[model samples]
Target: MPPLSTAATPPPALRQIGAWIAGLRRADIPEPVATVVSGCIADTLGVALAGARASAGRLVAADARDTYADGPATLLAGGRLCPEGAAFANVAAAHALDFDDNCYAGFVHGSAVVVPAALAAVEAAGGSGSDLLTAVTAGTEAQYVLADAVGNGVYHAGWWTTALFGAVGAAAAAAKAGGLTEAATADALAFALCGTGGLRACFGTDAKPLLAAQAAAGGVRATRLAARGLEVPHGVIEDPRGFARLMAAGAFDGQVPATLGRYWRLLDPGIDTKAYPVCLSAHAALDAVRDLMAEERLSEADIATVRCRVPPVVAANLTYDRPVTPAEARFSLPFAVACAMRYGTLGLEHLDEAVLADPSLGAAMGRVAMAADPGWNDDPERARRAPEGAEVTVVTLRGDSFTRFCAMPRGSAARPLAAAEHAAKFRACAVLAADRVPGPAEADRLYGRLRSLDRLPTLDGLLTP
Candidate 1:
């Protein structure tokens, strides 16, 4: 980067995004958008509390402690490290269970990366709560905007968009938190995109969340590099060999969302806060199965076969007919349907290794036949109760078949979880890490701080006294 704005090095599209990140403010953000963002922050922290105990979280926290040594940022779940290291650990923990807030338009886990990255950046600079909140909104906007800027080919092609666009978002948030101008922010964005790209194959492994963690750390590091006046290509996003061309293979045509700031992407085609712990591809199927089982009062023994109709893309992800591990089961539609039929629901409780290892689960998995349903979107929220999204046809031992269509899974924009429900989830997550997390009293205080974030002075109260 030549320092200051490089003239015409990047196409107008990338520069346009840069200007917006430079100008984002708590005042400019609409009330509804800010409110939604607060919920996202609370939800992400809730998930991270639980994730901190997961293998990915524990392993990364150890690395941050051993390698990072001393720093100014807290990991939220526990421990402290350098800002980037904290972000790496925190983001990984947030995504440990794949339950973080999601953006359907971008098809990425937005909150997992944004919250961790922004929190680390803000706390490191001793920034105010408004600064932290603003950083998150800017970061989310950048992620989705870049996701939209790049054609959907990368996602439909099965490359993880969260890892790809999320890095750029992380960089934007860090740049803002670090008080960079437009030129430095652009350079940071350029640096961040260099680390973009991850695989869907890592979905069930510890590697999946680590990929997200890497992106988070990469964002913070990119901003630091920019602030130190390190040199990166200016406006490399739309260059011949830049991010858009290199990442999209020339499919990206420089088109931008018409309403970048006029309307928050968080609201329109909104974020799908997951109700189920499984992959979003299978949430609709799981919802359908649970509803049918509850209505007919069917027992596991009574369930003969479940024919699940999803889009072809959805079926490709839920390929594990009889998953042998908890990770595999998390992506298995057959497994989700089986669990729903067996327990009348699927949740964190049913996703444990002990539950997955049961021999009886294999039989339940066999009875679920997942096929592609045309004329329907993969996302349940778009189903709009039109009976076109995901349908479950269950056959019982009595040879009677009961069918039902799920419009959308709960916790979606169409039927968002209330603030109390969101708090309930936070409490549940805190309970999982009770040994490390604050007690009920302190946790509630922290939550209240987030809800009225604009009034808080600094992020010192995010997790600590």
Candidate 2:
């Protein structure tokens, strides 16, 4: 890898992305984009703090602590590790509850991986808050641009695009945070893509979030190696036998990189901030059910049947009709709709074993059903427009009907959560880690710091009390 922008090796597409990353500055980002990036970083940190006590989070944090030497990067759970190790553990915690921000760009949980990686790399480099924001933008843009170029064919092909593309995004963010030049940044991208791939089978299990950990850590390692002048294979993404061809089934477009800085994908397709902890595939349906019940003033006892009309992709991903575990419940549309009918909301508390074993919840799940709209097959564009959207119909035991269609869930870009709502969520999630943060007051303090992350001179004491 070159120390400066020589661009002697990578193909045009990869080099174009590298040049964008190298040239990105704090001022180059539009205020709106930077605002969204800041919100996502704060949200990811909040969720990570909450998820630290989850089974997956606990296991990964322990593995990282035991395996890697201590260093400067702070884990959102607690303690410090080397940048790579910290990223590995923190990203897992961010994703363990499936509460992290999602993007249709690559159908990825973008911040769950990118934020932790950027946070670790920037802190390790002693970079400022502005540097962290700039690094996140660079990373998110590169990943989303590539996702646009490749389309969602790989996702439809059952590859976990979060892992496949997130690794590349993590590399971009880490490289930017570490101040790598264009050539070295391109090499980082290449090395990341060379080893990028994951299975969708990990869904509804601990493996899902752990794969996020692998991507985050792998990306940081790739950047560190590139910064050390490692000679990397160039054009790994566009190579005939490489990422695009193999992972995306030859679904590659050459024009997406040209519009990099000229257009920002983050503000357009935007991020989907989840309101519910369940799979995003189930959120639209959950929103619809919540609305129908509240509007009609119907209890779970009054509901005879609840039917969810969803896109084929949603139907495909949410296969757990009768979930017996919390992990499984996150992907279960029945569990999600039932929770909506019973409580009008889904929270981290609903994922507890006692809640999962509740017979009332089980009966409610039995009343809910989901099916794919065959019309989506005929009108592919409609499905593409609202891939995770749903139309729901609720029938009362008294023979009355109430129906609602939600094109997007509440926390989505079209209907963003209020700033106060973000703070409320942060407080709620933070209180879950009682062993790490002392009490509600401390969580509020941390929340304030995260929301004003751009003001911090360094991240050294940001997470500490």
Candidate 3:
């Protein structure tokens, strides 16, 4: 169903999110909200360490180092930079592999924008871990409310939600951490929203994740400018040419009155952590096929064809039937599903350069077909509840067909990974991230630090050599 049109009734306070964040406090966040904040920070930092090795990560770090001198914020694998510059590099690393956590309702990568911007602000202001948590929670909630209010129309129309709407959340985080007044925080958000947007067409290139990096950096800068007396239009969100009107292509839902802080989007319509670094859209198909392969002992040789029935939203992204590059493969159902069928799993190794040239893998990719299932989304609310739904069927050379329906992806809130499993995943990524792998003792220590970040006096120790 289409979102409520702009003709719908809306109150004057439609874009009051900044004012809301300006009023939030550490004590205001629920314990569950704080827990999600900690989990997001821990997960983002882990992925960023691994992602910092990617080409885009290196480029952003190099640029920041060349452009800005040392400062309070840590730049992950690289040396220090000014807070804004550091935010740019760190955000790049966090999103480099598209491995960061994401919320389905918000339609944004929550931590990719919030953590980098809030962390920079926290370090610059000498805030406590609780301060950091409060800032992140506020900022993430800002984006969630705004995105939900913006409706799903913008996302379906190909606007990159994180890149476009992420700055508003970033501004909220920075303002909260830096002690901006509610009015000033509101001003910062105005400037931030004005800088919105990125296109989904950039998905198969280095530009895709870099958009996230830009949003984080831009948000920090906007907050700083606002602190320095930058005044922007207060009602920009609801103005005739304003955010919801123009950016959303006039398909605004204007549900802010009903949504803002009434219930936490973080707890209710929670985010999903990834088991595979590929697109979330492909996870259900991959999971279904991988399970069938494991249970039946099916190999690439025995498999003749694989069919995946997915909703139109997911079908839109599974375009590359036979991906020729790692970037493309990350969004390809054929690549993820076929490889999982052939190898019985898809892991970090699948992202290596060798997978791109493997003829056997290419042959398997040829056997996988993805089709849009209108019936899959017949009940839109039900589809939204289990967004990863997929009907997967695998045919063998012996004319046998095995089918399974997957409604949830692994690492989702409903089907969460074990705590030990989550830590093991961090280790796997970290081993490839740094020049010297942390010893088991060091790894354990770091994990403890992340878990207790709300009490840490300073974040300075996290990235020091």
Q: Which pairs of residues collide in model 1? A: 1-231, 1-232
lDDT by residue (tens digit), candidate 1, 34-85: 9888888888987898889877889988887777656888875566788899
- The superposed Cα distance between candidate 1 and the true structure at residue 323, in angstroms, equals 2.0
**lDDT, residue 164, model 1:** 89
- The total number of steric clashes, by the backbone 3 Å criterion, in model 3 comes to 1
Q: Candidate 1, after superposition: displacement of residue 66 in Å?
A: 2.1
lDDT of 3 by residue, 342-414 (tens): 6777887887678868988888888999999878768977676767678999999999999998888898877
State the lDDT of candidate 2 residue by residue for 1-465, as single tens digits: 112234444355778898889989998998989999989888988899988889999999999999988999987667889999999999999999999898888798888899999999999999988888998898888888889889888898899989988898999999999989999998898888888888988889999999999998998999999999986766776778887777888887766786787778788789988888888999999989888888888888889999999888898889898888899999999999999889889999899789989999999999998989867657777665677899899999999988898888989887899988988888889888887778889988988887777898887677754
Candidate 3 TM-score, true structure as reference: 0.94
Residue pairs with backbone atoms closer than 3 Å in model 2 (clashes) = none
> What local distance difference test score does each model get?
0.79, 0.87, 0.81
